[model samples]
Target: MKKVSISLIVISQMLLGLTVSTTVSAAAKPITGVNCNGGFFVRTPDKHIHWIDEETEEHVQVYDKSDDIYAMAQCGTGVVTVFEKQIDGEQQYNAIYSPNCMNIGSEKGLSSHIYQGKEKINKIDAKDGKLEIRFVNNTYLRGETCASVSAGK
Candidate 1:
């Protein structure tokens, strides 16, 4: 009985070692293509649309711009509201920009390629009150961010 117990213990130790080794090996490998340097835009915000720059991490503003911008927050999730424009068109959009907060992972750095073939991305600079919609060849559509201080809210 004692011998059988020792054998079971040894087997368990071997299994544990194998499990640990596999986990370590899997974790050692790096994740690739985790960042979205550029892509296509689906919907562009206009006068009726307002959003918070996840970059600012606070404050909401009307995202009316044309520039090479990245709205990573839009890809994740956030709040949306519908409002009217001067042209009497109904527009729907997030009242605030709560982006997924994309970190420039693994990629070398932001380059012209960052704006390549981009269909839609809303880049916001809360500090400067600037917003931009970026597209091909690092081209952009820009606008002045609305100056509605959060203190008023």
Candidate 2:
């Protein structure tokens, strides 16, 4: 009877291991791309404005004069998009929005804004005289950002 009980325990452990592996694999799937039509605005400490293109991965310099720095992302369809932003030594902002250019919704100091959209993950790290923003798409963007921004329904 003892041998039988030990065998059953081993089988249960194997099954548990299999379940955990499956869950991890599903969660670790790579995000291929985002289906958004909007871009993100980032203002560096040197007073330079950078417009990051989500689709083309191009960086455009804007010569506008603005005091506040903000980042926004919008979807392409009518699906809901989740936006999250994290700043060094600052409170994180996480919010849900429709298909439009939604802000990060933070009232912190004016330096830089890092934005991440739905099905996308953003990793931001700032060090001595350098800032890095990495936008990763874990899944496709669902809705349209312009539709929500437009006046029509």
Candidate 3:
């Protein structure tokens, strides 16, 4: 009985060591991709979008400037509302501006490839005193984020 007990204890210790090592390595490795559920978000107040710079972590509010998606709280989710110029009944959207909060995971950085092709109007709707706009993007981190905008804002 003594011998059997010692063998079982040794075996359990070995398994525990293996598990610990695996968890450590996994945590140390950087994550490449993330789902759009909570990867990022947008807080809109008074017709401005709040953004946190990925590298600097600086609080920036440039309204229509597109940035990176490093973490979930770093603005990787939701549809960032941006106003575009209406040209002949078509909204002209310039790249590097007004991206739906979607973050693509990779080794280097986030992927900003969410384009509407020939289709414009990034899920925009204007009605009463408020407007609900959902910018569109491609890949893993695309979601809708609605906010308050004053009339003519």
Q: After superposition, which runs of candidate 2 have C-alpha atoms over 4 Å from their true positions?
A: 28-153
Tens-place lDDT digits, model 3, residues 43-119: 34233344454555554443432322212212223333222444676554422212234322211122232332223
Which residue window of length 10 is worst by lDDT in model 3? 102-111
Local accuracy of candidate 1 as per-residue lDDT tens digits, 126-145: 33444444433465544443
Give one digit per residue, the lDDT tens place, for model 2 in 1-153: 999999999999999999998776554121123333355555455444454667887765542333333333333331122233445645343323333222223212221223333323354332332333344643222222222221111
Task: Name the regions of candidate 3 deviating beyond 4 angstroms.
Answer: 28-98, 103-153
Q: RMSD (Cα, Å) of candidate 3?
A: 16.0
Q: All models: lDDT? A: 0.31, 0.38, 0.36
> 2 or 3: which has the higher lDDT?
2
* Model 1 accuracy (lDDT, Cα): 0.31
lDDT pick, better of 1 and 3: 3
Which of candidates 2 and 3 is the stronger one according to TM-score? Answer: 3
**In the order shown, what is each candidate's alpha-carbon RMSD?**
15.8, 17.1, 16.0
Estimate the TM-score of every prediction: 0.24, 0.23, 0.25
